[model samples]
Target: MSAEKTPGISAIDTTNFARQIVLDFEFAPVPKQRQRRGLRNEIIEVGAVKLDYHGNVMGEFSQFVQTEYTEGVAYPVRELTGISAVDTAMAGPLYVVIKRLSDWIGRYSAQVVCWSGADRRQLLTECQAKHIDPAAFPTDWADLQTFYTSIMDVGSHGCVSLSDAATWFGIEFDESTGHAHSALADARVTAKLLKQVMDGDYRVSPRAQEIRQRWGGWASEPRRAFPRSAPS
Candidate 1:
């Protein structure tokens, strides 16, 4: 189903979906040679949280996938995500991991929600590279970042990072939930933000207010980003 915008708030209508799988992926850039050959990044990890319309947790999934980079993950990737090559060495292949994730999704018709559209594009690119049908996995996807921006009434280019968004919502990232860059941690934070938006409990933090001012918008009251309505 397509998302409809709320009249004044310009937020997306998300009540039509049965469930949402908040997903995230950690990637390592391919070797220069592969990049020359048109390959970009490799999926090193996958993490997701399944949530019902009201934002109740239904299940969770996390997987590390073996990548072609045997030498090890790049220094930057390692530093950002703390995911070393050793962590993925014992993991299964990409297709296998994807299949397992699909199985975990089960028979429920759900929408895959990502912090941004990047994950969806990365998944499709990897599937194409492996000659795997992208349709084998849930293709119905939503970009939570877009919805978040709309809810905040920020300019298109004024979208904030996931960590920043979390901070705006007063969500603290600590050792318990890993850190900002970890795939599962990011997914969990995104899920939390989604719940806050759905419940109309989101507030524009000082930082978010700066963003709104810089991006040219007046401060507005916090409103539900996604309004619940009767199913079509």
Candidate 2:
């Protein structure tokens, strides 16, 4: 669904910070043998949406990065992200792609928002591997997944997937732009979800509420240890 038709999001407020960036990454799947050889999944795609304080779309950035996988993109990864080896083969190197992304973000004082902490971790790992200065990217990063869980008082220790959270808020994926797993699609959805939370127009599911109540709030109940049985 379009942002205008998204529920729980009202008219722009035109207050708060200057801009916020919603970001997502797609990683190439590493085989078990390669993983054993100290190879980690490399970022194949980067997608982001820049929004104003009022949640209006300012701009977007999307790029694909070539990977070191000589065997070409893994079948599963290609299937999941719809990014083929040909795509990465024709794309720029990781360092080049990241540089372009940093340049696109410019000197604007904007906070980078991602669906979860994993994206930040992945970025750090890749940057370190490429010897690219992480400082090139915005340091002010926020995990929207954590924020959503904490605010909804549900799954605070874990997280709801971006698509699941969107579904909970009656937000539909705009397939015309991209599919569910595509980085851009996910980032766009995340932007919408963030707007809903900021507007305080989202709802916590009844099931989530019931689960929290049964668990005596959002905190997890400690497991009771059974005493060892005496030998008969």
**Which numbered prediction scores highest in lDDT against the true structure?**
1
After superposition, which runs of candidate 2 have C-alpha atoms over 4 Å from their true positions? 1-17, 31-39, 153-157, 203-232
lDDT of 1 by residue, 1-69 (tens): 224232212223357667778899999888776652344888999999988878888888999999864
Clash counts for all predictions: 0, 0
Model 2, residue 221: distance off in Å is 21
Instruction: Put down candidate 2 lDDT per residue, 1-232, tens digits, no spaces.
Output: 1121222222222243467788999998666665523447788989999887667788889988887643578788888899988889999988898889888888877677788777777778767756678778777667777555554435433566686567656667776557888889889989888776555466544444444565466633222222222122
Residue pair clashes in candidate 1: none
Q: What is the C-alpha RMSD of each candidate to the true structure, in Å?
A: 4.6, 13.3
Candidate 1: residue 82 lDDT (0-100): 91
Off by over 4 Å in 1: 1-13, 153-157, 205-226, 230-232
| TM agreement with the true structure for every prediction | 0.83, 0.76
